[model samples]
Target: MVLHVFHGAGYERERVYAARVMFEEFLGLEIALHAGQEAGWRIVRGEEEDGKELRLADVLFRTPQGEWLTEKAMPSRPVPRWHTGGHPVKAPLVAPDVPVLYGEEVPNGGYLAVWDGGLQIGADLLGGAFWMLTRYEEIVRKERDVRGRYPAFASLAVQEHFYERPVVNEYLEILWWALRALWPDLERKKRRFTPRLSHDVDWPLMGAGRPFFQTVKRAAGDALRRRSAQAAVRRLGGWWRAAAHGDYDGDPYNTFDHLMEWSEQQGLRSAFYLIADHSGAGEVDGDYSLEEPWVRRLMRRIKERGHEIGLHPSYETYRDPRRLRREFDRLRLVCAEEGIEQERWGGRQHFLRWEAPGTWQAWEEAGLDYDSTLSFAERPGFRCGVCYEYPVFNLLTGEELKLRERPLIVMEQTVLHRQYLGLDPWEAWVLIDRLRTRCRLFDGEFSMLWHNSQLVDQGETDLYRRLVETM
Candidate 1:
């Protein structure tokens, strides 16, 4: 069935495009874009006519009579409602009279609701979804961290107290309910949400790849910085084991084999992103070389065991297509040498350093299948307003890129380390469980990242183990 959308001249093409994506790609429905008026299941930007229609104009669409299309609407704000089963939600799209058990409301706008036999939504859901999906706020907001990334605190969701919510998915749910009421015969596909586990081999082995002097310097620095003799002694022991046995498997940072074993025991697979090249200056990448014998052996082992090996593009490659291509080429060469032939590849950027459209364009140019780097470094939540993997769009040009994005939901360090949230193990576990429950609600993929070096901490390792087991 083709759902006809009647967009007026005041409607932006990008908004219409986003709505089309939501309806066709996400909702599995056919859309027929039309101008002016049309027949059967029509969506318009003005007050309802004498016939069947739905209104999604409000903030985005204007009437031909030179008047605003909706009621005196205000900018969306968090509406701390008792519904959503403890999940955060923006303003609701249904009326209070409809008896919606799960929804929110704005001040004067009431709830975003459907009228005229479910033919209309009173709010600008398409606009809201478009804004969230394209990260429209981030594009317009001029906030950046030291690494040129948008911090979580700067986000509209965070500022509005809904960063923990997947608002786009909630919008989709509103759409789903409307569509079901409109067309009862529509067959919607049931989605099964699953956990996507990935590891960034930032420091494959803490002591294995570093030069002897560098290792000694790190040990001494630890002693001086923390003023702890025990830490100094522990670092020395780790270095000795790494140097003598050529295998630091017993060391906390060298947890590759353990990771594989744990995954195997859980009957799951994970992606391992290995850094191929280090940056020249003013940037830090992993110390290990992709061509190192031990690294090669590990790569081969990961692939042999049915896990994925992907390129962890260096920090400098985030905006440079040429640099990204070169790094990916090196990774491909090494994988070929290891006799691993993967048809499609995906990865994340080092330090999560990315520059929106530029980084996305670079990933497409480098021929990556998907990228899982759209999350906050300082915090963990729905970075793109949705938990499902979706094709990325260049919000600037309104062009859809070839690359799909599996947005990272959480990173171990984001919640655990003192540099970030500094949550205790139990607190971190509770947060993860909450996020996972949200993912399940939408039947969306929950992507997680754990640095190989972090596994050295028993608390982190146990948390990871619990995470996998619970999933």
Candidate 2:
């Protein structure tokens, strides 16, 4: 059968996706057309082969406006008697749990098939406006401080970091138009949404247009408050504790059901980090108390769905090593009763705010197996100066901390915030491209943190889908 491989102009530039050349070479297919060629697709090879071999065609190109340009003539190739799905392919789709069976020898185990597992993409804007507002205040304070050192420093910093910079503003406009053009079907008809404009967007604010941000902010804040209140009610020795521990059973967030589908789709197994005392005093704005029953049920559901549960240390938990241990102990009991492993290992500090050396000491004392919270507080670049996971050592003591640091590369809030490296879609794309290049070279995982709520399909979030697709 004819195997067609369309090499679009832009797609050819992506090194990750450029393996089409090798694929074409192995298939012995001749390109009948080059879609993005200046003079349209000109057949470089014809029926020159003495025998009938499969021919491939480049059938697509990019127009000036970034739309795909396609050609009309189609090519056909002889189907091999042994070929299936247009080619003689091997194991096109494998079952999720297909294990290799060894003949005889010691008892057989499943066959080992390996693929690049380090590559990943995600975003997080959890705590939404709460986190952004704090960041905004911090930025203003920094701007003030810098002005004392140098008069022009404030403007320089603003131009470089703030999302309201001229470059970001121009890019955002283009990105907005582009997303609207691409996904008109997903557009909301109600103009009542104020756009989260660049100037009005604080790190705590949601997106690009103020009007739209207000709408989402109200809805999101209300939901957050409700979730917070419900959590508080549960923590008051209420039925939530019983329900979560399976004394009374029901799933909150339907986490098990949804995660099952999602994990299956991505061929991934997740490790969830649950906050032990989200509402406790000194938990750093941890005023929202979720029911113990809800939290327990969620943990059970996560385990049932084949995911691991870890601890998301409250703000003060890191401040006191003993308190951190106590928190983990309490968490372990929940896991133990559920017939799951009770060890509290992984951690992601709340707010990605931590004194590096001090926090490393706390993690070592608490014995976390891995931590995924290392990233720049003011930008979305590599904080540890590396793209790969490595041991995090205490800066003061110069001793290796007893944990692995999986540096977070991207978070949704960082890009959308008015402070920090507030990037629009185009700038975000440039960042992604650079990160992707590094990942390709080092074969490193682009571990990202995207909050579930930030996946909303409008306003300043235009780059999200593109980010995912590019990766």
Candidate 3:
């Protein structure tokens, strides 16, 4: 079935393309866009006509003097502070006739107006989805944290207190209901939702690449920080065991074997993003070389065990195509030398440093199949306003990139690190469960990033084990 959309003449090409993606690719609809007026279902930028016309348009679209409806138009509306299943939402639709997923009370004139014959939503869902899917706020909001990363607080979702909610999915649901009401034969693609577990091996080994003095210094620092001589002694003993006996089972950061065993027992597969290049000073890349014998052996073992050995592009290559190509090429060469043949490869950016179309362009040029780096460093939630994996689009050029973005829902550091939420293991598990439920509700993939180094800690490791078992 073809759903014709009649849009205003002044609409931007990028916005139109984004709407097409949301409707066609995401919402599973065949859409045909028309410049002016059309016959069937219509979407206009003005007041609705008094007739049996099935139309959907936001009141902001009727702006007498603006290029298009934007966040500026939202201020005039009664911004209601609302929550849906513990996820914050703003400007909720509250028309008594319109069925809302979650809200407080039905307002006199809700954002969405439903009737027996037609429906009219007072908000531009297409534009809103475009703004979020393209990361428009990141480009417009010129605020960055110490690491030159966009802080979650600086995001429109956070400012509007909806950071934890997947508003795009909510909008899609609204659209789905409206369309189904208008056309009962509408069909949608369905898939089983599951967690896509991944690990970023930022520090593969704590003592393998460090100097002897540095190892001792680390032990001393641990002793002082933890206020326990026993912890220091254990650290030194683990180093000695790894160095002399080639045993790393006791090493705090050496949890590869444990992870493999746990995954096997739980009947789940995971991807390990191995660092391909070393970083310069003031970077967060791994210290050990990818060519190290132990590293190569681990890669081979991971491949043999049916787990993926993906590349973890260094911090410096986040935006540099040349650097990213060099790193990816080196990783491919190493994998080839190890006799590992991967049909397609995927990975995430080190430190999660990404810069819009440039980063997507670099990944496309480098020929990476997919990337899972679109999550907040300071908070664990839906970063792209959705929970599903979708192909990325270059917001500037209005071209779809070859790379698929597996939206990351949670990262271990974002939840437990002192610099982030600093939640205890139980609290973190609760938050993870909540996010996972949202993914399940939408039949979306729940992508998670758990660093291999974090597994060395007993509490963190136990939490991961429990999560896998429950899943």
Candidate 4:
């Protein structure tokens, strides 16, 4: 099978080259070149056309008798071996310098190992010569040092890619090539990847029917209706409390009774995040020391109603590591008094204020199981730059921490935020639908955030609940 590398949208060519180098080193092998191009190889046609376009990588040899040939192509293959041997790869090792601009953190240095803005070179074209050489050296060392056991595979088990929007096609081709070289049998047997639809909603009935004319007609009607209602609401004001929860306001959703009732109806164990002293003035303190009886009653009722309680780790705590520890300490004590033995497993930073590496360190130190504050409210996409929850290395200590980050892909304010795409609830929902299309690209979890206060009945919050109900 021919290998192909497809980069994601808008990936820079230089970055692609760098990624190729890393991959080649991880896998110990020489990529056969297309005869004509001479610059890099690409597998175009069949074996006869090999070396012509530098099309495909030479991963294995197969004889006419259907027996697999060794890399050395001996009459009889030697017994299969593990890794060809090598030393453990250290962090911050940069590939040979090219003209490309690197991100602030060196490879494996910064909080994020992969940023989406990197470039991509065709897998067979630019090739991965440098990386292959490094791996070979490492392999030879392993063979010399270890008395027994070679690496089962020549390269790293996992591969990572970071690219922009436009070059995803090229990225895919490169992935196909890499997979072929690393796992020939697995690659040949597996089917190509396809995006899947995740969220469920009524579309055709909600005026999303066919034809350009129909969409335009419905959009115009919606615009007019919205404008008339906005004008009437401007003339007569209602409760403006909901709008105040923007940035400074904390724990503004006082609808504990309503939430408890709704959660019971749905049989969902919902978690309510409470900010400690940072909560707005006049709000009751629910910490361990001054456990107000009413607040305890609310927590008890919530438990009885089959919901969960969590802390909305305040924004200030993210920078001050101590704050995070203390806040979690207080939360645990409160939960203890309530006799809830199950340790809390959820966290979302207040205001989404976070530094990736620091936030992770804080979470690890606090013994938190998951952090759900990775996404930004201004952008409705992968905030940690990765779509899945995988154990990440600590940027400061280079330790592989065990905490998981559940990326929040969508948030209410993210849609209405004026800085980026200023989409109303309806507009935001449309964007969310587009994100849903991307979710099918991988099996990663799709996380969404909506504050309880944002759903309150107010002119500004007119369409928030409707959008949520649609979800």
* Clash-forming residue pairs, model 1: 54-119, 54-120, 92-104, 93-112, 93-113, 94-112
TM-score of each: 0.86, 0.45, 0.86, 0.48
The TM-score obtained by model 1 is 0.86
Query: Roughly what TM-score does model 3 have, to 2 decimal places?
Result: 0.86
Per-residue accuracy of model 3 over 371-401 as CA lDDT, tens digit each: 9999989988877888877778786676877
lDDT of each: 0.73, 0.39, 0.73, 0.41
Q: 1-471 in candidate 2: lDDT tens per residue?
A: 222322345433221112222222212233333445332111122344322222112222222323321111111122011112332122221112211110111112211111232110000111111112112122233332221211123232232332211121121122223223322332321212111100000111122112433434444554586444433332232233333453322212222343334544555555566666543545243322224454466568778776667766765654567777776766677678877873546767666645445666777777777777755545665444334445554433434445766666666677665565677767767876565554443344666654433433344345654554444
RMSD of each: 5.5, 21.9, 5.2, 19.4
Q: lDDT tens string, model 1, 1-471? A: 566676655445664667677887787777677766421224522233335445454444442324322222224444333343333233342212222212234333455444555444444566666666666666666789988898888876777666787877777776676666655676666688888999998877656546778878877876888565655666677777878886566555778887888878888888999898877734277577887887888898898899999879988888789999999999998888889999779999998998777888889888999999988988889878888888887866768877988889998889997889999899999998899888888888989998877775567779999998877
Q: How close is candidate 4 to the true structure, as a TM-score?
A: 0.48
Model 3, position 60, has a per-residue lDDT of 30
Q: Which residue segments of model 2 deviate by more than 4 Å?
A: 1-260, 278-291, 342-344, 422-430, 457-471
Candidate 3, superposed: residue stretches over 4 Å from native: 37-54, 58-108, 208-210, 225-231
lDDT of 4 by residue, 1-471 (tens): 433332322213332333343233222233432223222223332344332221222111112223222223221122111110122212111111111111122233321122232222222222222222112222232332121222212212111111111112222333444434434452222222221111111010111112334434444554575444432332122212223322212222344555445444544345666554343222122222226554566667666766666667654676667888888878778877887555545667776666536677788888887777755444566434334444544533535566766666676666765655577666776777666445444433556665654443363355643433333
Q: Supply every candidate's count of residue pairs whose N, Cα or C atoms clash at under 3 angstroms.
A: 6, 30, 0, 52
Clashes of 2: 30
Worst 10 residues of 2 by lDDT: 193-202
TM-score, cand. 2: 0.45
Alpha-carbon deviation at 217 in model 4, angstroms: 44
* Two-way lDDT contest, 2 vs 4, winner: 4
